[model samples]
Target chain A: MANTGSNQVPTADVASVASSPRPYLPGDLAMWFFILAELTVFAIFIIGFAVTRQLYPDMFQQGQTYLHPVAGGINTIALISSSCLVALSLNAIKHSRQNYAAALLGGALLTASVYLAVKSWEYNELIQQGFGLSTNTYFTLYFFITAFHFMHVILGMIILGSMAFKTTKGAYQGKSLSGFESGACYWHMVDLVWIIIFPLLYVIN
Target chain B: MKPFGKMEYCWWTLIGITLFNTFLGEQFSSSALVSILVALTVMFKGLMIIDHFMELRHAHRYLRLMMRAYLIFFPSLIIVTTFL
Candidate 1:
């Protein structure tokens, strides 16, 4: 590996900082905008949930009786763990620790799997109990919001998987890390959404 | 205290809060005070993610504040709508 400078910071990184000056934003500017847009859409949906719950407080209360708080708790831990791993993975990659970063990405994927598994278990249980989206207003919103988030989780895993592949090949070493940072940042957005959703759906009830 | 030598400390705090929220959820049904507390917790968790996990504390002022708006807005909305 070519040594860029005494700070051990790569030339690309030094260039990034010099170009931006102090108070660096860590990922692609476009990615940040994308995250904001996504957040807006979800905000609308959650507000809908709140309004509908207000309209039919009894129905929502009935719905909450079936939710498993323990499962939600486990899923929260899983997603937060995955987010931390992704952040640490980016930190490792920034330092050019490619293999370690790749491993961290793998760990992130594994933890994310825990979230999916717990969610799937919840969905299956809800379905087996004869609850469907059409069951009532509450179930409909529940399925819609969570299914949308579930799809995002799958997409995030794909992005992380691609990053892990490229990391193992040293694609980001001594090079611009914008692509990797963008992907990592996206994964964190998923966790961010869940951080609210868990309480909104399961805990608030 | 090099409290944040790594992401370790933030991660642990998040885990603790998740468990706490779970406890709150199970221990009490939906009430005004509980709802407000839960919404506040959402804001706290949002700040933790934005500052630490997303590394936005050292970020540009405008961009960081944009993210902050989302994290803060929704929870506040939840609080307001709770009273509605």
Candidate 2:
């Protein structure tokens, strides 16, 4: 573990301060602030979706019926499984198991790839069936929400890709885990948003 | 602190619950009972990810509270506006 002390502090003071419990936020506080802001915007979007659904019940229901719930469900599992691998990767790094951590991060990247591929397939099908964003209010909202989320997934994959590389280099060990945790936090937020999105756009009628 | 052993278990549990929620939604699409159940399931899944996957279980009190609020507020809004 890296010493949780400043060079100016004496050795005895450093030891005592390290032993004392202090509340700490995971990752960078700035990252947490970013996450909170991101979530707030998503919440607004979801609320707007709900309100629109209320106004156009028949159109929303009809649009939802055309969607493939099974595809959405499969993607849900993929993202959640990827999230598990990300969390497990952090666990491995915490134990200084660099190879294991790299392997787990690799697994997470694969699962994320699966999610993107499945999403692409779904989008292809939608377009092939002539369901463009201008199809209707429901399709507009659906395409917008999902495509926006799709971008986030891609961004997350990029972050995980770098983290995996760093893990193989043994860069994130012990007190150096905040970067890894921050990446995981962002990935989990993607999964969290999808958890609600899947049901809202796919399952609910 | 079994050091990550429990995480895989939590992962599987999340998968099982999510699958179960999908099953409920499919079986009872028009049932008010299922709507409430589905909303609750979404909230539960979000909480699990925030607490376990995100490690908010060890986070500061304000952070934990903020997450809790997000988990509750959004799902409740969805249920009220859509189901009711």
Candidate 3:
């Protein structure tokens, strides 16, 4: 309710505006649907990982031995850091802080790159040790799940890169932020999935 | 700390939770209790992400419900399958 001079502005006039709930679902409708679809795929892979581990405890246990839990922890921190950057960047955009948002998004991209580097190094080490997809059921599912997620991280990095570029141009300043929100949401999904993946794969054992 | 908004607080708590969960998980390993704890931790983290990070707290009811369901169901499924 904008203040008026006399201060007796009719209550009925602004009642709806003041009373109505702003149930804002951030991001594009299409993006939410896409998030749901992507989550469904990841869910299936994760469930498969669980079910297969049940069937082959020994294999899964051995596979866990070959994994680098320390690396997993590092990647977890990296992803979480990136997610935080994405969220903070969007918040910056909301405040019309373009350069700050761009810097944060760039930080996000860099953190995600850290995750990619660690993951790729882990993959290389595993391959050098003869742990390919065909190695066993455990390695098969391991490669299947992690590789799928790895690709998503790469895609997320691309999205963040683009978002950072646009942020620098002041494109989102004082504008409808659905696009900015969507990219941030996607990066967060990648992070959310990792929050589950790291504990399940490396910590829970 | 003085100027932090809700999102900043959420971010800080999330970092704390992640590190804490990692520590607890390592300490307990694969015990039945730790397994269940892991499941619950995942749920908590998912809720924080979907509701807070994703800002779905004020979104339509079903969207939050659906995402919540996914986070809950999978961890529960893992717990069930672990004993099978």
Tens digits of per-residue lDDT for model 2 on A31-142?
Answer: 7887888888888878888989989999998888777777788889999999999988776666567898799989988988998999999999989999998999999999
lDDT of 1 by residue, A53-167 (tens): 8899889989999999999999999999999999888777766678998999999999999989999999999999999999999999999999999999999999999999999
Clashing pairs in 1: none
- lDDT score for residue A199 of model 1: 92
lDDT winner between candidates 2 and 3: 2
Best by lDDT: 1
lDDT string for model 3 (A57-174, tens) is 8888878878877788778888888888898787677656789889999999999999999999999999999889899998888888889899999999999999999889977765
Docking class of 2: medium
Cα lDDT, model 2, residue A96: 67
Query: How much of the true A–B contact set does each candidate keep?
Result: 0.84, 0.61, 0.53
For DockQ, candidate 1 versus 2, the one ahead is 1
- The positional error of residue A72 in candidate 3, measured at the CA in angstroms, is 0.9
- Shift of residue A132 alpha carbon in model 1, Å: 1.0
**How high is the lDDT of residue B32 in model 3?**
74
Q: Against the true structure, what is each candidate's TM-score?
A: 0.91, 0.90, 0.88
For candidate 2, what is the lDDT?
A: 0.79
**Tens digit of lDDT per residue, candidate 3, span B6-78?**
6677777777777776676556557777777778877887888887677767665787788889888887876
Give the TM-score, chain B only, in order for the candidates: 0.87, 0.80, 0.78
